[model samples]
Target: MAAVTEPLLRTERMALRQVTRSDVDRLVLLNNDDGVMRYLDWRPPTREQVVAEVEILLKAYEVYPRHGQLIAELADSTFVGWFSLAVGADGPAAPELGYRLRTAHWGAGLATEGSQAMINYAFAELEAERVVAETMFVNAGSRRVMEKCGMRHIETFHVEFDNPLPGTELGEVRYQITREEWLVARTSR
Candidate 1:
């Protein structure tokens, strides 16, 4: 039998574990929700798209250990959603935080809870210089979560999507928290 590895991160209400092939079905449902996808892909990702993405994420785990998407779940194993501290071309020194929760779990502070945990991991464990997150300018809820996690608005930039979603005209916003800022906030809390 395979040994059960510990979760990558944990919070008061959830555990974040590495994403697995088995998570595809749950992820498909998450990627399909209208409200959840509203500010994201803007179109539901088909199963094939989700599957291929999962395969890539799985491969990334082998190469980049703890820097990728993770499955967030309750203690009882109920799926909430996913959170990520993903590396871009700039690599692991700076990671972008991202998340999506089930609409059923909306308004419960789960997004904020999970985000705070990810930021902590980025600064404390990863020794990252900075952490960042981005969302559509009109995504008030996401922006609020970033604020609550001690990130500050850093930029507003436009991207020309081939087919833009409504409110794309307002552009997108980026939020960031530096290691110094995170340390100060950590001490104050």
Candidate 2:
């Protein structure tokens, strides 16, 4: 396996790069906006919280680059959001994929573009056996992105949350696509 380092990934309209401390203000704005965070854990984070989060993300890069993280940016270099492919906390090697985007960037197919790129990297470069995604059932947009990435519905599971978001009562849906499935789909295409 190759050492994971901050990798610069290009998509149709975005670039995925390492998140930096300088991104605090943009991250704060993205997190604070209720529309953008409707499916997330908390409301927008404080500037301090954003700073702390950046530190944690950066540290993770040092410890695990390939499974680390990436910040999605526009061609002009505006921060759109972030994406990650990391091992689940549970005792499994299956990589969990996730993304967050600015509300303004929604409905533009950017998520699908960025996600597909990550999916390709995971399967072809990382040689991952499978990739998985989860979203609150009501988050139709996110579900669509996962489906578009070729991940099919796997299961729905409920996990208790202290201060659950508006859609938590709906439970979460899991979606997955194995490398074999992906290859078969690609060959058929």
By TM-score, the best candidate is 1
- Model 1 lDDT tens row, 15-117: 8998888888999888776599989875888999999999999899898898999899898888899999999866788899999999999999999999999
Stretches off by above 4 angstroms in model 2 are 1-7, 90-93
Residue 2 displacement in candidate 2 (angstroms): 26
For all candidates in order, the CA lDDT equals 0.91, 0.81
Model 1, which residues run further than 4 Å from truth?
1-5
Displacement of the residue 135 alpha carbon in candidate 1, Å: 0.6
What's the residue-level lDDT of 160 in candidate 2?
A: 98
What TM-score number comes out for model 2? 0.89
